[model samples]
Target: MLNSNLLRKLDMQDLMVFIAVYQQSSVTGVSEALFVSQSTVSYCLKKLRTSFEDDLFINTRTGMRPTHKACTMYAHVLKILESINLCHAGPATFDPTRQAVTFNICAPEYFEHLILPRLLKNFDFADLPVIVNMHKLETDIPADELRDGSLDLVICFGPNFHRSHPDFKSQVLVEDDLVCVFDKRATPLEPRFSLQAFVERRHVFPTPWTSTTNMVDGWLARQAYKRQIVARANSYSAALKMITGTDFILTLPRRIQKLLAKDTIFNHCEAPNGLPGFTLNMQWSQNSDPDSANTWLRDQVLKACAEQGLS
Candidate 1:
């Protein structure tokens, strides 16, 4: 059997006063401990006794003594107080080494290839594993994913990207320009190719991952030029492989060119005719803007970029 009316009258403050009186053995003692006046403690104690329908404490020759009911309720009240304290304390500090946190980052294949190795090499994930799920950037910003917490962050090129989502926060992670790559064995022995020679070569161009328009072609179109495309590949790796043992040349980001050319025999030079460069930026939902774990993840990325000289 429960007392509904008594439940309404009882509150956290009442419980605190009763607990303080029980522990301190006197209202005046409770007042001194809690830095409240003796009258305030008495008022709350009176309410608590009315709520319980019991003389919760009685004055004795030595001190105030808790009744049987008060003694029975003391443990429950202490637990409730501890829970209340926890609730008001805010979120705990994030410890990556102690807590497992998975970070979801979206990027194009090129950005993934360039950043993943560097990020893993620099981050010290010794105790607890930090998982990173990398997804390819799409033609449109995944606003629903960002809002709903399905995705944690995105890194991609295009300054105008994510402009539609005002709640999305973004920072430039790296800047890179376009460069032309071709097999050193097949390319003409020249310091640099003229714009005419650049356009004349059979090009192995990479198709954009999520868009129909080729970014390289779009850039060339703005300058009233077009390349003789021999084939189109879906990713930078595919495009890089297609040009191997052939005269076909691939135009790609300078950083990506350097990374892919590490093992492969390739010659690279600045793209002819002053091709446009792009900046890759990292974006996260403002919903996580104040989250400590997300902030640490972003910092790790910035550190990786710095180590790679991309920042």
Candidate 2:
């Protein structure tokens, strides 16, 4: 027989708040962690104290110190919360090929221009009832949105521009060398290009990040040579347009040049020998690592990269 008094007093949200308070050890921390108001956490704590017939947490100089009762409840509350998550996740029954899913991805123009077309061309996702919503990449790691289920995946240039967290998983998906693009009619260069031409010429930088500096510039700085950046465009396509029929040079990834090979208007040359290549990495929340749908999507991306010889 179950006790109706305890059952009536129990609330899932209160238990969640209790668990959060235990973990955070501060009312403000709990509020932010759970995305709730401090007053709401206080209300939940009051209910927890009444239901348990004890002040679960004691205010201390350092933080909210857990009482003996709270210490005992911690493991049990954790299990309950995890069980609730598993119930909602339903990974055991997930079938990616037939499941209805909407994936929200955060990516930069780099992914859009280079990888997405190949992925779409090689895979049939629309028929599978899969919709991919792309959001502009904001940071090296957008953990807050990913943690709250606002974003399913993130793709960005790395390993220079990467921040790792224990709750997220990342993998390098593709790599490519650098090449310098110029309009041959406007800024003709011999097959034997010299580093002097690279520095003497004005350059157009294409990058989504606010900073115009990159690995290329870092190498140049090491050698005490800095290329003059005449213009900074928000994307590579824009930079290409800005430099075409002009003397401005745009140095970008070789894969980008491969994609634009048909455009006779722009010609690419081997980058200064020592300039390093770049890598693109894909990241996802750890919670999604075991999800069948996520697994399928990641596999599809890898397949596209392998087929396109871009891996």
Candidate 3:
């Protein structure tokens, strides 16, 4: 039933070129994106057409549009490319001290306060050429970005974040409870902050760029209680600064409290009971899990957490 000659006519490189052309929609765009020449793209497209007996892509004023047959074959083509990649993936052996590779990670700004610093310190043990790129954690970080090799790892919080993406494998890095922060000069905490006082005080809440809701506000809403938010800021550092000269209070993760405690201007207490805590987790694409380099990175993170006594 199979045509041996037809099978022989197809090349893996031609399939890859076809995929690039289909996704980019322009010969020039494919060339630029894939680091190939336009002539090469044209030659491949010509071969593809001759084999399939159809013009896979048509040039128009807007861009290169895929023919109906080409549109139907797009998903299959992607799978083929993916299978080829998996087939060619070598064993997961990497030397962090010698391998010249860059690792990209994404996490929230709050992580920059404690976790990130410790993680970076762990990397100092390796004397090899290594580059670490950090990206801001977005609320809607696309699963495809991780799958496509754009990000190596993600450090984030939640009970539900990334639950929808089955391709992401996550491990708990730390569990942190909420704490109430106040200026030592303005708010006097003889023992601990009372629930009544916690709700009555003017709050300086840090609102992340991706969402309007703050962590403290969400917990309060669940209890049918709402604090008087005097102001909202985008950075936790800014919120901490605001409470320094005023009676406003901030409720954030306990790790942050410890990080800022040495400043002496701010003091923190346990957040009132009933408020929810969060789990910080490290996630990586399952496709990258087999790579020895990614395994090394994961181990380093866990080591950092252990050094901080979070494990």
Best by TM-score: 1
Cand. 1 TM to true fold: 0.72
Candidate 2: lDDT of 185? 73
User: lDDT for every model?
Assistant: 0.80, 0.80, 0.79
Worst 10 residues of 1 by lDDT: 120-129
Clashes of each: 0, 0, 0
For model 1, residues 212-293, the per-residue Cα lDDT tens digits are 5656777778878788999989888888889888999888888888777744588887677666788888888999987888
> What stretches of model 3 exceed 4 Å from their correct place?
1-92, 161-163
Per-candidate RMSD vs. true structure?
Answer: 7.6, 15.0, 14.0
lDDT of 2 by residue, 192-265 (tens): 34778789889998876544457778889998899999998888878888987788888888877777634678
What tens-digit string does per-residue lDDT give for candidate 3 at 155-182? Answer: 8777764445777898988888888888
Runs of candidate 1 exceeding 4 Å displacement: 1-26, 35-90, 122-125, 161-163
Provide the clash count, candidate 3: 0
Candidate 3 lDDT for residue 130: 70
Instruction: Report residue 86 deviation for candidate 2 (angstroms).
Output: 11
Task: Please report, as a residue range, the 10-residue window in candidate 3 with the lowest summed lDDT.
Answer: 207-216
